[model samples]
Target: MIIKKTKTILATTMTSAMLLPSAVLGKEDGRRVLEEVIVTAQKRAQSLQEIPMSVSAISGDMATDAAIVDTTDLVQYTPNVKFTAANPAYSSTSIRGFGTPPLAQNLEPSVGLVIDGVSYGRSTFTNDAVFDLERLEVLRGPQGTLFGKNTVAGVLNFTTAAPSFDLSGYINVAEESLDGKRYEAALGFPIIDDVLAARISWRKRDKSFGLYNTTRNNEEEQFKDESMRLKLDWFPFEGGEINLLAFKSDFESVGNGMQHSHITPSGFQVYREADPQTEDDEFNNTRATNAPTFTSRFSEAIALKMSVDTGDNWVFRNASLTAIASRAQVDTPYLLDSDFGPVNALSLETDGPDRYKQEQFELRYTADSDVLFGWGDSVDWVIGMFVGESHATVTQFARQNLTGLAQLAPLIAEGRGVPNAGAAEVAALNALIGAVPNGEQDVFAVNYVRVFAESYALFAQADWHLSSSLTTSLGIRLGKETKDGANGSFANTPVPALVAGQENFDNEGSKKEYEVSPKLAVSWSPSDELTVFGNIAKGFKSGGYSG
Candidate 1:
């Protein structure tokens, strides 16, 4: 009876396997076969099953099939991963219940994002549209040894399709509801036959606003995006390869459909809820204003990687070295309705604009040798050093109107109908208005914040095989980070006495921190089909001031 049950289970599994796509499944002897997945979770190419860490890898084809254009779409398919977007320019990603809020420019992300082996310092850049990808690997846990600092949660690695020697190209077009349209295309060919190759890709997206504004008799939340990338590969000589990448992206959007839920006792209000599924046009409160809310972002990046082989030796056999350099810049300008009501209570805009720049350099060496006193067949190890610098400038301006203040003054005055109901009140209001040069809306506050950071790290990891069936790995990373910041605020009000402590102020500070992360893991494989693994690791994320 037990044998019959086992046979039934195996048959069911085989039937399910046959139903899967041929690209995801292998065929051998006219039978369905499970294919092995290759990954670089440990900074080296290896089979997914051979790695002892928990990881999820999604192929570009699978992403395209699912119509996944951004990081938020990945949450639906990945377990223990969550993505939240405060706006198109800011997002937070969490893995294993560890994450940070994307509220300020000075804050750092706990989860790290890596593209083509170069790490991104800011989470704002992670939500960009994805195109021409080879694979995306989500490594769950503290990947401090291989990825360095700010990887307390995990690491997301995106590998783009490489340039091919053969001519190849593809074009994809998609249309969706709300007049949304998307186009993507790629082309690859050889420039110097087997010595050099190039690939270029382009993507564009346009979508209509999903929310209707009854006050304005129009819509909000519309967006248009465009991006392009170029990649080049050169085999300058034997045992050496060089890769160069350049990318540029631009994103533009209209007002967000954020709505005001409640007003505080002091007439202060904030956005609390916005329901996109609601068909009622009046549900969203937006004022009809000549100044349309706008958000624009432009980003550009350049990266280079070179890999060379160093001749073999008794201690460092099969040695190879890799070097990487990358630089990126982002600029953004935003304007929004701060009150979220159908009245011109408060309007917020960037004082000037927001700007960010980052640069990084890394060098890594890897080898397979009997460095562990000839303990096993071979010892695989890697060592690397990284240096990075980032700078950010952000500013905001809030404008408040007398019309909005009058709407709230009545409620604050108890039985008073309006600010002009009595002669004394009218005179006081007139006096306040006269204090302003324009006798119109005044700048409530001007906030300016700047941040500068520099970081350096040394990391190493090694795997020692106790025997053919058992292996152990040890890794460590030592890092130091320093940050300098300035936050200043200037309040422009008609009546300064009424708003105490709202004067001009400036605060400057600096911080320096160091951390050491370590990891140990053991894996035992008694048979080819079964393996058991255990690991212990420590991780930490850097801290910074809130602007």
Candidate 2:
């Protein structure tokens, strides 16, 4: 009997209005007011009401109240945002129907994720657990110029809380059904009063699997995760400050709860569904898989930021200069059942270790007078530069059972009615059967891939306050990237003909690409309660070789 079934998960995103202080309002009505939200969506600190863009900001308190632990949960509170996980190591995201599939390691994400002013290059980093955050900002639409490349859809920016001079600490613990438990703690204090401060935070989570494995007689997809962060702030001199952050995380899981549901034969429209009671069920109520799966990941990062304020003494009055440097590393390994059946047929394993580093600097000059650009204090601008590099190495191995293939070949031949099979065919079958020595199959294939990428950009954005009610903005970015890749694969088999064109394959390649993205926008505030804006922008994503 052949049966087919499909399953889907419904996702939702929400937006809530914030109440600002009543002092900003002209009249004191009984109506509840919304608080003013300040954000850096345009690379500067400004009131959300002043910026002419679609943005959603979530405070740390809100995230904690809702138990938002990861990007998947964070998206549910933002409008038009969705997150899908293909596995523990891969995830895809979309904003306003514009997104990229996490189909391959070399594929770049359409959305950009930035933390503490440092941009993350890979989608895998999006899965990092969230903790001790000051706020989270989701910027919709093409952030072409100021945000740089790979932001065709939108940007997710996270800002961690800064250290305070006053000593403070907090701890939280929670337990829920399904053996889920969480613990988090944070402490902040002054190292030197009014000059230096530090904050430290840690979190741990343990959860049981959501699915039951009948074959193993245990719950699958169990997980344990730990994360830590340290932050420091220094006020070296008047109008200057330095901030540093370091973070580390470790995650391990027994299984991902992926069940085999169906098998389809070649040239057949119908497929046979795995029996729910026989180790191939796909329902949430009952599930079964014969193979043991495991996954582990570890990551760490460090970043430094410095900002200096140059008073009206310079020609570029009220000037502020900023610089940032950061480095991060990630390592992951996993094993899965390739055949997904009670019968032993195949297994797959992969190990990957990746490193990423970046350096950035920016300088913004606000006119004290109409001396420099003749626009006076009505115009403000910023110029910046960025350089980043990433290297990744991945190894994969697969094992297949020759005995199973040998047992199925005769039936296939018989079903096809091939009388007096040729000697070559018989020899091939004998070779396959013979390769399974010592009651086990041989290694089917081993593959390796390494990629190194380097990228840099020069960008600038300027805003012109044409009048009290209107503003105009223009921005542009010039970026270039280069990548080098190396790949090789080897297959094991006794039959020389069967192994032909499958062993000792190696290749190396390189590519270089450049792009220019620009943006223009106009905003008008008709009243304190209403704002209108329109923008035209170009989006770009770099191209790279597939693994």
Candidate topping TM-score: 1
Q: Over 4 Å off in model 1, which ranges?
A: 1-23, 210-221, 258-291, 408-431, 438-440, 494-503
For candidate 2, the per-residue lDDT at 119 reads 82
lDDT of 2: 0.70
Which residue segments of model 2 deviate by more than 4 Å?
1-29, 210-220, 258-290, 351-377, 404-431, 435-440, 494-504
The TM-scores of all predictions, comma-separated, are 0.86, 0.83
**What is the Å distance of residue 312 in model 2 from its true position?**
3.1
In the range 1-547, model 1's lDDT, one tens digit per residue, is: 0000000000000111111111377699999666777888888898765566667888888888988888888666777888887675666888878877766555667788888888887776775436888888888777777897777788888888889999998999999776899999999999999999999999998998566565556776689989999999999999999999989999999877554344443223211112222232345544233236888888889999999999796578889899999999888888887655555556778887688899999999998877467567667889999999999888878776654545544333534554443445445555666667785555477878888889999999888888887888899989888888888778776353343345577888887878688888776777665666666666767666555
**Candidates' C-alpha lDDT:** 0.74, 0.70
Residue 144 lDDT in candidate 2: 64
Output the lDDT of residue 132, model 1: 84
- Which residue pairs overlap in candidate 1's backbone? none
For candidate 2, the per-residue lDDT at 276 reads 32
lDDT of 2 by residue, 244-312 (tens): 988888988887657655533420111112223553346664455556888777878888888888766
* Alpha-carbon RMSD of each model: 9.4, 7.4
